[model samples]
Target: MTHVITYDIGTTGLKTCVFEITNQIQLIGSTTEGYDLKILENGGAEQDPNDWWNAMCLTTRRVLQENHLSPEDIQGISFCAQMQGLVLVDKHGEPIRKAMSYIDYRAKKEQKEGIGNGFKIGGANIVKLSKSLYITGAVSASVKDPVWKYKWVQQNEPENFHKVHKWLDVKEFLISKCTNKFVMTEDSAFATLLYDVRKGKKRFSREICQMFGVKMEHLPEIIRCTDMAGKLTEGAANELSLKEGVPVFGGGGDASLIGVGAGAVGPGSTHIYFGTSGWVSTVVKKRVLDINHMIASIIGANSGHFNYFAELETAGKCLEWVKDHLAMDESNLYLEKNQISEEKAVVYKNLYDYMMDAIAHVPAGSNGVIFTPWLHGNRCPFEDPNARGMFFNIGINSGKSDLIHAVLEGICYHFRWQLEAQEKKVNTSPVIRFVGGGALAPITCQILSNVLNRNIEVVEEPHNVGAVGAAVVTAVGLGLLSKIDDANQLIQVRDRYTPDPETKRTYDKYFPVFQSLYKNNKKAFEVLNSQ
Candidate 1:
């Protein structure tokens, strides 16, 4: 039986899996490896490209060895990576500097000028710097379009920019390492702020490149997501324990692949992902740009398709921070009282369970308390980088559980805001499919369902959806599947959560207050940051 090997290179780690083509299900053989993102002061995020390659090699080797399969058993390999990271490479494909990740805020200075001063491009002024430059054309032309983090590198690190040969996205860098092919997918290319979304074509926008002082030849050739980029070279194959000549399909950004993997294809199908960041996206037959341009519309996985994605800059990360900081005192108390190692493990689980139970007991809307989930910044509806999270209506009676519930509700309120904006643009209200680490939390999923007043379908195998999506793309590239719909039929839905009517009604009342908090506090946040 033929199998497809897939890699999902996410922000936190690499996940490698082998899927059987006939059943369209993942086999038992899989491996995982962790990777770290270097966070610098002033919200700068960087990573060595070699770390991804090394993790890919180590995990691939382990998967092969654990499965006891020969390299010849694998048919094809493809990858899905985090979107919008900027990597500079030399002519020989060697990385010139650490990759500037999507999370990095060092470009805030450039972004501020573009959005704050109302820089106009294509005959319109963009209000939010990050959104305007990324979605609109208020960027420099010299460096393959200044909408990318590359512009920040050019202005801030001139010496490093001078040595740069080619600019590649994270997935493109991996493809170059595996097959020596420098190619990019449309999904990744559209995020660069250079691609003309209306035209559905990609090239180094000479207009923007000139502004940034970069040449067009510095960019990679853009291709469709399903295109056969190249074959695995002997060296990469040997290192990963895979066969040479195995076709490497042009994969896509994690969001696009997750949409495909969750079967969120065709019109009206939507998926909401909650990881470090939160996103709500829906597939459309054609591009539908918002009138206000509040949400980002980008190229979808399939050719001639498009997706509208609304993001909340922080989701799970907010919860993680609360757990780490607020729960530390409780954690230490439990640890000191617990005697054995096994008891200590139980204590940790009990603490988390207690927190969830407390959150579950709290009524919908957290008794009028609201959170913004803008710990990182606002991504959609507001698009304000200066946006700060707030816990409004907190009282002396409010405890840790109320605070936790409020945070979760705040994130849900943001989703509702995006959904309302989306409904105005699209005629339909579709059921939402949940995928990613956040879906694992039952309380959070239930809260989302209550707030959105829609059924939420959580995939049983949420963690591997992106990897599975990549394998499905590989299958299509290799002629195993004729259309994406065929692959969709093979996908299984494991669980479904329905919203409670009472909870939904409660959330309906509180969502407006949630909206007002941001409006009233926006200027305050900006002023506070300025100081």
Candidate 2:
């Protein structure tokens, strides 16, 4: 039986899985050790590219050893990685500096200025920083696309940037390590906010280039998701216990893979992922640009497929922050009782369970308390990076449970806002498929259903959907699957949840209050940030 090896390089760690292409049985598993996120003084989030490499190597070795399968048994390997990250490499394929993750906010001011009226560039241009010089004929104005955060490094840290030759995303960087080839898939490229989604081509926009001041040659070649970029090098194969010449297919951005894993390949299907962050995405047969520019549109994995991704900057992270700050004492007590020294895991879980049970007792809408789920900032519909989280209409009797419930309801209300915006552009409301770490929480899922008033289906193996999606793309690239749709037959949904009418009614009443809070507080938020 032919087998496909899939890897998902995420914000936290690297997950590697081996699967049979014919039966779709996941036979082997391993994960690389996670690396720590370095948060600098000025809101900088960075990680060493070498850490990603180590994780890939460690996981590949573990998967090979645990499965006890010969390298020849694996037919192909593909990857799905975190999006919108920047990595710089020298001519010899060496990293010039640490990778700046998508969450990094150091460029917030630059992003704001880039999208302003002077150049008439779209809001998407704000996310990337690339330089474009138009000295020659029809000189394409190349601004420093946000993908060139490394270029920013070059200007700011002359020593490190001087050593840089080619800059790549995490997906391309990892693949280059194994194959010694410089290649990045289209879906990943689009996330850098560099590629023109309308044209479906890989080239820097002249107007944007002039605005950002970034060079074009610094970017990697963007290939189709299923294209075989190169073969695994013999040295890499031996080190990871993989067969030489194993075809390495071009992998896609993690969101696209998640769409496939959530069985949202067909038009009209929507997938909502609540993990460390939350996103609501739908697959489109054609590119659906938001005239309002509230949502982010990007290329999808399947040929001719496009997708719209709407996000909540902090869905899971908000709860985490609350637990860390508000529930610290309670968490310490639990950790002491359980003999668990890790306050984060022990406290978060205990806090989450307590909050869930408490919220279950309160009526929907958290008894008139409204919350703004903008702990980080708003992404979808509003696209306000400077937005802040808030709780409105707090009563004198409000307690921990009420606050927790309001936060959950706030997140769901944000989902409602995104869905309303999407429904205006797309024809399908099709069911919302929930995936990721948050999907495992029954209360969270039910709360979401109540607020959205739609049936929510949860995939059984939520953790590896991205990996499976990568495997499917690899199979299609290798001619094992005729089309993207064919892979749908292999996907399975483990469970489903329907909305409760009573809860939905209560949430609907409170949603308007949630909207009003944002409207009233918008100018205040901007003023606070300005100070």
Candidate 3:
């Protein structure tokens, strides 16, 4: 079987998967390798570029060997990574320092230091914001932007900044290692906030680059997701157990590719991704920018399509935190009683099973409880770094299950908020294609569907959507597929969760309260955080 390979570079690990492309795509094998994400006390998140490369080599070799495939079996390769981070490399393509992850907020001070400011009310020059939005459809006024981090290195690490030959996102950096050509996908450029994503002119905005004192030359050439960037170099090929000249396609950022993988490539169709982070996004026909609400678009999997991204910083992570701290030691309990290995115990005795049993018993509205899922601050519907997670109106009757249910419902409420915004600003479909780690839970999908009052469909192998997208685009590059949308046949809906009228009625009452809670606490969030 002719196969295509895909690499999903995420915040916590790198996943490599292989898919066979005949009349339809079929997953052959997949594996993941983990790496450390250094979350500094001062609100910094960084990852080693070498570690990323190491994980790629490890996962690729393992997946290939397990599948009993040879180097020549794979025809094409593509990649997508968690977007909105900076990876600076020297002239020889050696990383100058650790990469700033998309969630990294170390540039907060840098946002006020000089022209690097990326957030309004954070020392950003007013004229710069107007000019940037006019030319680029985005601006660097947000510290979390890669441009702000680029400027941070310029101000704080001037020596390394001067040595920097180019700045690439996770996707470009990984592809460069294989192709020996430093290039970026259009989607990656849009995430940089320095690109002119204006409907007619899409390129590095010279004006914004000048305004931020970032040399346009430091940016790599932009290419479409299906473009054949270059062939695998001898060193990379040997490391990956692949052919020396295997073609590598320019796969896009995770936001767009995930939609393609979920079989939501058509315009106005939307998907909700819940991973280490979360967002509500849809494919659109035109570029969109609502700077006031911080709602925007990056390049999508399809060339002319725009991906309207309403980002939420903390979704699954909030649940993860709760599971790690609040949930009982199920693995240990099984280990002591059954004498099973820790890994096997974890696999056989699922934590979600435990939580879901209790959560299922709890009624809607979490027994009059509410949760705010801004554990790491927020980026969509509005950008507020000062915002934080909160559980409101708790009483003596509240139990662990109610709290757990509250967290799940809280995340769904936020999705509804973003969906409403998209319905007004961008065309959002009534049904949502749900994919990611959170969607693995049937209870989570049901809660989201009821809260949003829409159908939530889960496709087979939801967690692997990103890989599917990359594989499909690689197939497109290799002429194995007609277009991205042709991937629909390869996807199968595992189940669909419909809104229960009674539960939807309850959520309708609580959703408005959820909206007001954020606004009522907005200034207080800033003031308390400032102190």
Candidate 4:
């Protein structure tokens, strides 16, 4: 057993968690620090690399300090972070400019335009097309991938393009600051849509890189997720107030780590996660791609497996949107009209909790209020950039509680669709290991159970699951554990939820109509969104 430290840098902020793992898992402590995301009017999203570093240092020191533990007590450090975002850094590991996020779709124009060597899918020749599918398992016509951003920068910001020395994902950039080594884990490399994963050949594709006009030297050295990146440097350790030579492991992306954290590391294991964005992911032994549905398998945190991801672009974020924007104002107005004190109106303050509590009292299907949770289009069951969120079958009787209830149901319906659609390509176990910030809510987990009609196990410390998974990978790398599968034993399931008959009946009625919304609006989505 060893005490491992893991840093999970997510879309909203950075979290540092300390875990003690042996035959059973225990989360000793965790601290989080928030950072701002810059969203431009031109469909750009960016964040400062330094802000992430500052948050990392702050949380790392806080977790260690509050626990009264010395840095030497920790065996290894690892990470999980927002993936697919492109962070370009100089030779010294300093960022050349603000990093672009995965949600940034500003590069869409460049994505469709032809690149050198016929790089992107739409621009690719027959040879390039055949090789990309065979090796990488998928390529996108959307700007979601970094390769497209690389093309975006060349045509839009040539100065930034020329100054780039190396391209790094969020985790790789952090690891470089820690070890002073410019290296990337295979998982992050694969997400760039630039690496080759034709089983047994784990290398970046030179032909693909050349086609996109990417310099081979601009990419960092590839290493296994469980491999040791290096010892933490003195300068880095000083910033975090950690031991100078603690070993750092190459951690994988957030999705893969969340899989391991929820005890879904076995080749056929499956789990569902609800974060800012969410997904249903399963572990597989080989590269599996459902190009028609846009579900792609990326490298798993476990050294030898792949995580089949059915991604949903918006999941828990919809709740946040409603909580802050829709309900907060109403909650305040209600309090004032009732003459409730700020101290007495406690329920009104915690908007998310109030919504969940409200939803718990409402029947499934939200009394015939149906919502489509496609706030940011959708990523699974189908790929569409123009899809929009909608509320249907609502009457004057429908109130805030019904709307909130419908949003939760709508998201579950989406997952139910994912479960059905993905099962055609990969074997998804009937039981799901649920983990994420949203999994803590009984209403959310229960809805998931009812809609998917599967037994669900909720993680004890749901928010820390991502960090636990990264720490588990570090444990395997440090020889504290024999293999990644040991994570199954270390992760504990706190509770289980079974489907409710009455709730399932309501969902059964609405799920079909929910599925049809996209088809009904497909033409409208394209037309209304066309520039």
Could you report the Cα RMSD, in angstroms, for every candidate shown? Answer: 3.8, 4.8, 3.0, 2.7
TM-score for every candidate vs. truth? 0.89, 0.86, 0.93, 0.94
Model 1, runs deviating above 4 Å: 112-148, 197-204, 211-214, 291-293, 330-334, 337-358
Model 2 Cα displacement at 76 (Å)?
A: 2.1
lDDT of each structure? 0.75, 0.73, 0.85, 0.83
Question: Residue by residue across 106-147, what tens digits does model 4's lDDT show?
Answer: 776776663324533344445656767776776754556688
lDDT of 3 by residue, 191-211 (tens): 888888766778898878887
Deviating ranges (above 4 Å) for candidate 4: 114-127, 330-332, 335-350
The number of the candidate with the highest lDDT is 3
Enumerate residue pairs that collide in model 4.
Answer: none
| Candidate 3: C-alpha RMSD after superposition | 3.0
lDDT of 4 at 338: 35
User: What residue runs in model 2 are displaced by over 4 Å at the alpha carbon?
Assistant: 23-32, 117-151, 196-211, 291-293, 322-362, 393-397, 527-531
Candidate 3 versus the native: TM-score? 0.93
**Any idea what lDDT model 3 has?**
0.85
Task: Evaluate residue 27 in candidate 3 and report its C-alpha lDDT on the 0 to 100 scale.
Answer: 89
Query: Mind giving the per-residue lDDT tens digits that candidate 1 earns over 1-531?
Result: 578888888887888888887866665577889878887766667899999999999999888888887888888888888888889998878999998777666676665444334565432344333343543333222111225477688788889888888889888999998889889888887777666554543554665555434577877898878889899999988888788998999888887898888887777788888877778888777666653535656777866566777777678778877777665455576665433357555664645555676577888878767787888556577556567888888888887778888888888888888888887777444578888877877888899998998999887577678887887788888888876667788777888889899888888899898899878988888787531
